[model samples]
Target: MSPPSATLPAIAVAGLAKTYGDVQAVAGIDFTVSQGSVTALLGGNGAGKTTTIAMLLGLLKPSAGSITVLGTDMLHDRHAVLPRLNFSSPYVDLPHRLTVRQNLRVFAQLYDVPGPKQRIAQLAQKLDFTTLLDRPAGALSAGQKTRVALAKALINRPELLLLDEPTASLDPDTADWVRGLLEDYRAERGATILLASHNMAEVERLCDQVLMMKQGRIVDRGTPTELIERYGRDNLEEVFLDIARGRGKAAQPAQAETAA
Candidate 1:
């Protein structure tokens, strides 16, 4: 089947490129994320996933090309468009000196969430953060911190959610819970998500489409099942390994192989 059209992507990128001094961080790449769908940007370190996201979020300028989020040009309408998006990354920490509740409150204020108290209460119940509210951010375990970060990301009721390893530090149960929560949020709000993750299983489970990057360029892309079938692999991990190890270019029939 053909990919979606280019009229108005929830997130649209074309000829996107970025360079720092002599190093080309992101070669010209193009992709479109449909509205209300989860799209995974998959790549290993230095694959330009972070650089691409930074440009989309208007945190970094692209050396070339254009990007539009929710039909608003990121470069020209950044001020008006920023409020419609929020980002969460496990590697990025919240304020260590503040308590969990304090951190949430600060962000809630920044987002101007109506009745911040009630919103906090609701998210606390949903995320099981009631007990950890008074604890300093630095004192929480990795999993706990991840939950708080996620809550902060959602406080804005953003149209576009950018998640970098949302489930990175959580145990299996908590991670599963977080995934379910994301599904529920998407269902209720029709939100679009751009996720970058190393967890291929999570990507397969959550993403409607996937963009695979290599050395700052998108070398391949498809749904998880499409990629798995195309690579003659049992799962996305194998596909990722093959690509990472320089075997991705080898021609193979698009058929599922027995699980290894």
Candidate 2:
């Protein structure tokens, strides 16, 4: 694929929706993630965060609407953009028998990364999983596996990175370290990161914008500070609680920021 126009948003979804039987997993939602920013998708369980991310990754076909990722149509031209993006989720497991290094090498090749071995080595060292590289993925502890998963997601140095609960299973110190690594990566590469996380503090710290979803629809969106102030709350967590509990002032449909 040719280079996308720099002015295009990293991700643009219009009237995006998905359903299963009688249940609508994601109601019509429209939003765009600006290029070179960290955007957080926040919601409680069954709120469509995962469903939306899956559609963005082209892992699940949307029942309606459209998704343009990195300026390429996801439904019809995903292959043209897939190489430019990667996703990580702790809930998804790697093959149990493959060693950490082996697993990363496989993903590296799939992304057509140059110097797969060197990229794997760089990631293992950067993620502090060098010692676990030879261990079977199933043999690693939860935190170890989380680090390895992150390494795999980053193997290709993708322009877009999607993460779900990125710091899950990590201790406080390690989680903070990982967050710093992500911040540095974005700073260096101007990468766009879209993450679904329950960790409010992490979102407040890393995200430039936040989209709050409830019942499959995006109910609110703004910078963390903007949301907090608008809700008259002390912090993002409080604002989140207000929205989740249906006590906060109702929000109008978001006009996604073109420059976050």
Candidate 3:
């Protein structure tokens, strides 16, 4: 892989907004994700986390603002950069009738991944899903499906990976194992990861930076330690509750630095 740009963020959003009729889904938020770092996007339901990610993926057009992904304008040039990134979400399911291997092969082809068969084999072995590769997707349990989804996300070795509730439906042991895979993937490939998860422990363990959202805007952002100290919390879960419930106001430091 080429050296990452010193100046450009892997993802840069300025004044990003999305609206549905009279309701604002995302209210002109601005943030940057550094290359080769793991960042978490935390928010309660209806906080616009999903909307923001959709806009980033060009699945939904922004009402107002700009999105530059990997130095390409996502609004006008999304196709050029789409292949460089991949996303995984439990909400998005693979074709039910397709076998696990078939699904992976299809995605690998879409991403133009070289050596698709070898790549699929490697992922199946690493994720410990080799036995399920030939099973129909609809026949797999939730945990098994989650692993398959993750494998599809990694099929192309994307430079930018966006994951939503990556460990949903996973057993504790398997979840930990998957997290290890993610850590290794980032270190070995120098990939940048943005994950949205309700599992605060998972966020704290995997993330280097945290972006907290409320009412469609970024309310605070910092290292996990910084937010914990600022919010006077023992863990990210506590800080999350403090922010989500309006127990604490956005800090001066975050407000000064962030465009909310």
Judging by lDDT against the true structure, name the best candidate. Answer: 3
Ranking of predictions according to lDDT? 3, 2, 1
Please write out the lDDT profile of model 2 over residues 1-260, one tens digit for every residue: 56656799999999999999899999999989999999999999989999999999999999999999998999998998888999899668999899998898888888889999988888888998888889999999998988888888888888999999999899999999999999999998899999999999999999999999889988889999998878788888987787787775543223223212
Candidate 1 vs. true structure, TM-score = 0.91
Q: How far is candidate 2 from the true structure (C-alpha RMSD, Å)?
A: 2.7
Error of 3 at 102 (Å): 0.7
| Ordered list by TM-score, greatest first | 3, 2, 1
Q: Work out the TM-score per prediction.
A: 0.91, 0.94, 0.95
Summing lDDT over every window of 10 consecutive residues in candidate 1, give the lowest-scoring window: 251-260
Alpha-carbon local distance difference test for all models:
0.86, 0.89, 0.90
- Write the number of the candidate with greater lDDT, choosing between 2 and 3: 3
Q: Where is model 3 more than 4 Å wrong at Cα?
A: 1-3, 248-260
RMSD of 3: 2.1
- Candidate 2 global lDDT: 0.89
In the range 1-260, model 1's lDDT, one tens digit per residue, is 12223355788899999999999999899888988899999989999888888899888999999998887789888887777789998557998999988999999998888999889888889999899999999999999999999999999888889998899989999999999999999899888999999989889999999888878988778889988987789999999888777676323423222210
User: Which lDDT tens digits does candidate 3 get at residues 1-260?
Assistant: 33469578999999999999999999999899999999999999988888888899999999999999899999998998888899998778999999999999999999999999999999999999999999999999999999899999999999999998899899899999999999999999999999988989899999999999889988888889988987778999998898887776443345525433
Q: Which residue runs of candidate 2 sit more than 4 Å off their true CA positions? A: 250-260
Clash number for candidate 3: 0
lDDT, residue 247, model 2: 70
Clashing pairs in 3: none
